[model samples]
Target: MTHPARLFLDRAPSPIGELLLVTDETGLLRAVDFHDFESRLRRLLRLHYGDLALETGEAPRSTKVAFARYFAGEVNALSALAWDTGGTPFQRAVWRALTAIPPGQTVTYSELARRVERPAAIRAVGAANGANPLSLVAPCHRVIGMDGALTGYAGGIERKRWLLAHEGVVQAKPMPLAT
Candidate 1:
């Protein structure tokens, strides 16, 4: 039987909340989520990795710097971060399409489905988006409802709204995340 990996777990503060970052020994990002949603993170880790050994450690320096820069208003800062994930081919395709969504842009689930050439699988696309393990690094927050409403962010709607505003989708001043 294959053995799951021992990953490094680190926590950092972001405007949204405390971020939990998991990376492999080689420093490749394995997962990212809010501290408040650790249960979800653990669930995803199990879903993808079978079982894992987590050590209290820091993420790679470059990854940390990139995230800090993104939080500092260099929204495209994460475009170059190194990360990895595993899923079905369709899920991988949807996650890849998400990265192509340039900073400051938002697309509906229908449009994301179209990008992956599964124009009729909008619901499936939404499910894949939800299963995204590398949140901001994958840019899944940029996806919105078909009617342009903020919808279904695992991180919470207020954080999603703050992210959209942080990316300049709305001109209003950024709001603090709901506690």
Candidate 2:
């Protein structure tokens, strides 16, 4: 994902909230974030791709259809969609690892850190996870703390909880998640 990408914008309703999907002309997903987090979304887009026009347009049919299916109970619908993001090599690696996490499973930041082969980079992994532009598609919500406690999620903790339940991951939380 180079800077100054010509990205198209689309919106779709989901169980959690309204999602704004950013896609390249070729239908490659560039980003996905909630409409309520428009400011954060803008900041991330700017940070990742620099200056670019996010024109008002419909995403490709496949992109829209995939999301529809995803929210409609076809949990694996998103696995086939092509997405790319602009980030440092490390961030990209972390995002790829996130995608590898199956929908109904989770891994701690330390575990994810080791998965990236940078065991000492747990904090760095957490930072990169925070910077991920793709939300549900990248499945960043599946990353948790080492104590089986839900940690920070860019989409918010409640949404993370809903997503985990939606995916059938039952966890015994040892601590309270801030509302």
Candidate 3:
């Protein structure tokens, strides 16, 4: 028998702004900003919940604790997370490489592809980065453009800048041209 789909939401103040966290039986599916957030969130909800009841104010027991630690810079790494990924094998490989990027450090798409021994798959690596489902937990935001410019982030460019800034990346420095 298939288990019912259920979603729970909780609000937590984050460095970037107020974020709405959503979780399901599968895992933590989304963490989104509350203000000026796009309607894509509802679409995501429909796709995941599929008519299942979305019960708010019932976040997983200790999620707030984790968020507090993460925001305070006390949690340099993440563990015990339940991530649900459905992507191609190559995409999974790219996601795995992304997780290896430590806090406060960054990597370029081409660099990541090279690490996977697929230097020719830079474009493919970018595609996989775009397809990552776990967002911040997967640390996709740490991937930057080869030219040192802030590239695309599923969460939006502003949020990406905020994440980098929060991690001590100096935005005022001039970006280097891609070599």
Candidate lDDT values, in order? 0.86, 0.87, 0.67
Q: Is candidate 2 or candidate 3 better by lDDT?
A: 2
Candidate 1 total steric clashes: 0
Candidate 1 vs candidate 3, lDDT winner: 1
Q: Estimate, for each residue in 1-179, the C-alpha lDDT of model 3 and write its tens digit.
A: 13336666667777777766776665554443343453455555555446666567555556666666777875453545554444557876887788788777788889999988899999988987876655667778888887778887777777887777777777423444579
What digit string (tens of lDDT, one per residue) describes model 2 on residues 2-89?
A: 5544888889989789999998877789999998898888888888877887888898889889999988888788888899989999
Name the best candidate (by lDDT).
2
Query: Residues 43-145, candidate 1, lDDT per residue (tens digit)?
Result: 8888887777677998888998888999999999998987777777898899889999988889989999999999999999999999999899888989988
TM-score of 3: 0.72
In model 1, what is the error at residue 87, expressed in angstroms? 1.6
- The TM-score obtained by model 1 is 0.91
Sequence-dependent TM-score of model 2: 0.94
* Best of the candidates, TM-score: 2
**Please, what is the TM-score per model?**
0.91, 0.94, 0.72
